[model samples]
Target: MAVASDKTTWTIALVGNPNTGKSTLFGALSGVAQKVGNYPGVTVEKKVGEVVHDGRRWLLVDLPGTYSLAPRSPDEMVTVDVLLGRQSDVAPPDVVVCVASAGNLSRNLYLVGQALELGRPVVVALTMNDLAEAEGTKVDAEGLSRSLGVPVVPIQARRGEGLEALKDAVESAGAAPPPTVPQVFPEPFRNEVDRLADVLNGRQLPRYLIERLLLDVGAHIEDRIGLAEPDRLQLRARIDEARKRLAEVGCKTPDVETTARYAWIARATEGVVTHAGETGSRFADRLDSVLTHKLWGSLILAAVMLLTFSAVFSWATVPMDWIDAGFEALGGLVEGALPEGPVRDLLVGGIIGGVGAVVIFLPQILILIGLLTILEECGYLARAAYLMDRIMVRVGLSGRSFIPLLSSFACAIPGVMATRVIENRRDRLTTILIAPLMSCSARLPVYTLMIGAFIPARAYLGGWLQLQGLTLLAMYLVGVVVAALAALILKRTFLRSATPVFLMEMPAYQWPSPIVVVRRMLDRGWDFLYNAGTIIFAVSVVMWGLLYYPRLSHEDLAPMVADRERAEARLEAAKAANDDAAAADAEDAVAAAENHIAGAQQRQSLLGRAGRLIEPLVKPLGWDWRIGSAALASFPAREVVVSTLGVIFDVGEDVEDEGEGRLSQALQSATWPDSGKPLFTIPVALSVMVFFALCAQCVSTLAVIWRETGSWTWPALSFAYMTALAYVGAFLTYQIGTWLGA
Candidate 1:
């Protein structure tokens, strides 16, 4: 008679514990069409994706995977808040799908049992059926379904099986009348919960769901009915007596609801599942032997990292060269077509040159993401974390802190957000403070220019090694070692205390799917372009304005230049008329005089006065004021450094014709006015690269870190430390190297 009346739309929340294939299922169901956003103001990742099944549409909300919804951290509280709809901002779900890994059903059931008692239309999706089969375990899906009063669907999401069955079950559950919310405890224990609830009512605590659960477990009564020394002795006797009574009735004292939930699950599992044979899969054994060993584990991790860096360095160059050539040609075309006026300078010299410098690093970003995807999907990443735990523990960092720190190597924002994985508040905060200290790929362009120009390509140690590449490698290693030592010192002095133990679930090794790896790589590339590109583009335009003003007009310089050039013919005749080249010398002197006269005319231009004003302070840094001015102008975007140098050296015309390819020529001819020495010597170049590597010079990184940390203090500290470290490090490198006659 009910006829499953037409509720075609279903609201499904995918709930599961951590490392339970929940995200994998979400990605599989949603494809690339999912939208990932934040939960209101918090950085907890929220994913909403849609799917159409059997002509019925379903909206899925992927909640953060947690071991239990105990509200331990802000991220963990998000799960409880969403489920209870207490946030006022988020909508409550119509149906709940609890995802469980069949391999670890006992631990996974802990979350599912809580969801079931919430009285929502629930379905349990058992994942990793293939792994279950290999373990010789056969779950009686129907029997388990009947026993729990909910449908149990066993499926391998990776293989795309049982999806139709899952959809049908979800549809049926949605059409059915909503089930009554079940009481979590049995009769006798229910009485104790009510007594505890009475005590909480008198205290006038907030009616949050977690507070209710805590009260139901007697924590509220303990706090309210405080006892002095003599009263405590009497209360302890009563508490022990009550515990004996609870055990007599097959109940537990400390956490009655938790004890009841586990007991129910244990009873439901009896005779419904079977364990087959031994689990000696040769591949797994061999992997564990090598990856879990103390010595070889770290060695393998080092080798994998070295290979990844090598790929990023070598493979990225081909596309980088292509991009470089295209920009150069475009700049030439813009200059040639726009008639050498102010308009041409803005488009060719200002905008194109400025933005092109930033865009050239895209190839490196893509390659790094691609390789990292492979490492993660193949499951070596988890093993790497386990192996590094030994070293991390010694440095006062948990093994879980490794992922957050490692993610910072790409960017600090995501890495800071990833600190949610570190459940310990102190450890998470410490990791966030040091994340920016890692040298991100944003520093790659600066390093490449210096290393390529100054570091010789010749080999050392009798031709057995390449000296140039090794120097570049050493720079990367310096960042890592420095970061580790900084973290150690911070934990010891400022946040000194006991370290939290690290716990992680390592997935079994498997051959990675190509589609998933590519999908992940493309996602990271898109994130970088959208997040970093906009900031860099705006900064480039601003830097261009600072360098482009005060252009010399052809008409304004005619009176002064015409007087000087009129004597050029007499000087040439003097040169031709001389017997021993004395006349030639006179003509050369006349040409030099006319050029000097023209330069004096330019000295009155707006840019000339600005350069002269800053000359005093910059002289000590081995930078004649012109180089100092360019450095100041290039602050918004580092790639503008070369172009600004071109403008200040009076080679702007040549660079506009050939693009950045002319940077070497421009720098070679630049000289300090006071000392007449080359401005960019080996020491200066190395010092400049070190500064870029250490500073939070990019505005985008600053903005993202601010948003992620939800405070100006952390991002400000990040910027201050990095900039101070950069300046001091660079100052020492330059002074010592030049003093040692480098």
Candidate 2:
């Protein structure tokens, strides 16, 4: 047996249609330890892992799952670039492991055939053999291998069956001669491709890319072809002529490829696959009927979402509270241990208070991601998207927009990047524009802070419903409602286009892999924590300085200091005499004098001055300078609003006996300077949450928009429109709520 041409390391690329146990096979091969990050210059995630077998290292690169090799968008083009070894940092695979579903051989083999045409060594790993057998279709691996002149191995990745044999087959195939390349285009179309290849002599386009170039209409692959201005015009003319000739011969450019491929597949699989049982699982069929039904499915989806949101509030409450208390104690410890200076303030006010505010919401973010992973694993997410398509279509979108929008609930950055899957430019831009309005995890801290503080924990319906959870749910719904309306208007006006037809392949329902779910949840959680430690940490430190700097002059502070000193003297005298009543009064007086100086110093800080300048603009939203300043400080990342609030309220330095809920307590006790009324009313909290909910406050999301759109115009437009909408929304919310005596 030849072992990959004597190379020390073999690159094995795993290509497959989705839901074919590709990821499962990857886990078994690489021990579920994969390095994940974005591919160079693209948003598509690159998942690669490695294993040492027989003293030879094999790098397993798991490509994204797709039905075809056609390159329509940048993300799809990434698949082609990797196969041809054009993607940076990824070596050409010695052998391509095309993971095919055993039961769905014909459809699964479609991508396998495409991979074969790439002129690389190809090995078919037939997965879901048990599912195939259950459906009464038995595939003879030897017979199929012989038919295609390639090795085929039937394996159950979940049970780890035939994995060793499959690995051996990959080794053998890598050293074996390349399999016969499958031709999917007709004779006339092939002639056109040949002619076009010769015409582009200056360009080193791959044979596979040439075929796709002629077949893929209105795709992004032309850029990958890299034709010069003159060459592009000449290439377009030649392509059009070739397409015309093929059309005259009744061989269409695109559909001809599909038709010819299936014809070849029909002959290749002859007498090899047998069916004895029903086509599919009866239980799954019946389950989908209820789950995908219009009326019942919609209700179930609503219930599922409500339960998910409810879990975020209920399940994450204890952990969040614990984290909050832990940070509070740490801050207090740092304060007492260090001297009163910038260094001590930096640790307590900047690090602990600022970063801790956002870190406290990690539990809720993790729970949400984990549950979404479960729903997606169990295959309900696809069905939910199918259900939402009806509403989406009315807004000039299809079910294809649902996944990206749903992803926004976790984080808008990924959600905005995911629009590459949609080929339509107008629809993609429209989706990206409305994506940040989906109330991503970045907004969760603001919502939790407001809802947990102001919304009463009243129970209804025999304790099934809680006011706080409902309030959280409403904030999310507000974002969704606004996104839908915005999408509708964008499609009708700026990004006007018809809703593209959505064709989805529903994956079989199965138990979610614990490894995948936990890894994903932890990955997202770590991202959250890492950001808190880095960008949010830096922002927090800067905010602390803005609030703490420009100390009161001696002339300005002498009177307040004297008052505090006098109160301290009285406290010492009363305590020495063991007069408990007088001691209590003196303690109150001392606290009052200290808080007064703290307030006076804050009013004179840099941030406070800026806040006062914008106070008039936001007064209609029931906000004072302090709230306006926090919003201004948090423009970089919406979650930083929590950190800003923590610094503003002197969270860890609350009244001596007040322990947990430090920020909330400070807000409740905060009052206007001129009037002693509370600063944060129910209406004010609602206004803040609603504003954060609707705002385009994340700088990262805007940058991604610029990258995806290849223009600064869209991001600028997004920021401008969303900011105005937020202000108006917040103003109305506060003004109306106050009128209703909220």
Candidate 3:
């Protein structure tokens, strides 16, 4: 390895397998001081944090977790390229710190073995030692260090234990000579690698990387190296000859390397590690008996999901209400302080109302994310995935895909971000395409409103279930079913590929640290607010402008003003006569007249015209121009539908008072202009709910999809397919319901 000569400021690369507490160590070492950005050409997160210890400064780069240096995906390719010093943006690390789990030593060391081949000084930070002791496994750190020819430090990153020692060890490695570990390959294979390396004619490539290129079939290193056409053909011929000779010697290229590496590791750890003989079941194994049970585990997973959703709805209700009222009071203050003009209107409607609509959902978002973090930290998420693997595999996905899809229940943006854990590109892309169909929390408001207004409060199963609650649950299930079918279809057609192997390590269950969970929640919340929230805010402003522009002139309200004047005069006359009933009737008439004028003005706005233009297309689904207008306004956010309907119905866009029946009352009492028949029936309400449940209404979801995929093609395809499915689903429901009633 080419180490930095100056060594004033060392660059240390932290590498490890997933779930080894590598991130926890990074956090403990760096605290809150870090910078996050995307890699130069890939969307994978690149985190660089600083560590100042003992008057020495270290720049630590936390690389993505990978099982091996073989580049199967862009994420792994980045990890390999950076460690190989091929990435131009980053300097090669002065020393490598491989964090390993004491409990899963053998598997963790597989990665460490690969790191040793990179020629950099390697230091092992062994974690989870306490858990290993509990499982009757003892690792002698000194002996293991001697065997591996490196310094090993035991650390409990969560508690900030052994971090100082780890730092010292890292510093020591930086000052030492670069390790020259010989290859573990058999003589025949080593000879083949030597021949291949010699063919390159003194190229600047490292010997280990050249060996990797020969072993990793169809690796990207060939493309990255930029070899001439003639040299590439010659290199290919040499690699084929090497493999043929190795096969004649009763050895396979890839399998032989894996066997040789493991054999060497076994010999190195033979006397250094000791295990209790055939002990009784440990806590994890015992817990897995029930948690990973096929039938009971599925039920447990369902109950967990139910509890999470229930908490999001129940616990967040109070905070959501508080936020709504606060914004409403602010809007009222703006109205009361300013005169009746366009400036006041824009502040009240565009800024406060539009922004508040998105902000009110923050409580639910935080609650959902916080709960998921706790579950993940406690390691129950892995068991949940294991339980769902059987079902997911049928749809061309592994158990790993379930976590991301489940996260979609809270929001599709984070769900898309969570797909980075899936190593296979085809699986990850397929998951991203269908994630939004999981019916996120944004659709909850629309679902609750429609069901409350239409579905009766009758109970079933001895009051254990209510008809309205069942309808809400059924809407969520519909999304789940549709998303599964869509995934199967996509895998079978558009993104078809062989199913990659799925292997997940189940860490021992432990109590999650509040600090860690809270930090993670805050990180995700900030990411959402920064990346997706900006797009939501901009879209909200555009929608507000569309609804606010083309204001009706004072002359246009002359007739309604005269009608209000007549009602007021009647009210005054009745009051003077002390006729309470007559005065009440006159008051109602005045309010109705004012509401009519407001609705008329809204109908003349730009958004209103666009809604009318699309009314014909939506008419078959039992939606009138007003409902269409609300739907169109909610394109930026699903929860905006309630506020949009309130605005269109002249209810003042404050729909938080559901008990007072403001927006629902308006919808129920509404009538068609031509037939004078009630517009919102049970069938119409069900159709609208179905459409919202399946439609791609949230622009935040689309933005995240674009960011994750690094292209617009997938997001565009997602929007098109989902919107089409929603229309068709709603159309069929409306037509069938109307026919049944007839």
Of the candidates shown, which would achieve the greatest lDDT relative to the real structure?
A: 2
Which stretches of candidate 3 lie above 4 Å from their native place? Answer: 1-5, 277-281, 403-429, 440-475, 494-500, 527-533, 634-686, 698-714, 733-742
TM-scores of all predicted structures: 0.80, 0.93, 0.89
Task: Itemize residue pairs with steric clashes in candidate 2.
Answer: 136-277
lDDT of 3: 0.80
Candidate-wise lDDT, in order = 0.67, 0.87, 0.80
Give lDDT tens digits, candidate 2, residues 688-712. Answer: 9999999999999999899888899
Which residue segments of model 2 deviate by more than 4 Å? 1-3, 31-43, 130-138, 155-163, 183-192, 195-204, 219-223, 228-241, 566-586, 654-660
Q: Sort every candidate by lDDT, greatest first.
A: 2, 3, 1
Ordered list by TM-score, greatest first: 2, 3, 1
Instruction: Spell out the clash pairs found in candidate 3.
Output: none
Tens-place lDDT digits, model 1, residues 1-742? 1323375665578899876778878878878769878898687888888988788767788998887755656676777667755555556666788998877787788788777655568889998767666656677888878777888998767677887788788887877865555455677666644544464465443333423343234333343345466754654455555556766887765477577778888877787877876463555667788988888887777767766655565677678667767777787787788786667866765566655654566787688777877788677888888887887788799888888877877776677788887766668877887776666665665666566556665655564445555655566666666677777987898767677788888775566767777777777667655534565555545545554545457786666576556556566666566644666665665655554543454354444556567767555455565666655665554445544554444332443323233444456555554455677887887777766666666565677667766778867877788777777767777888799888
lDDT of 2 at 198: 94
lDDT of 3 by residue, 513-585 (tens): 7889889778756754553346555655566667767878889889888999999999999999999999999
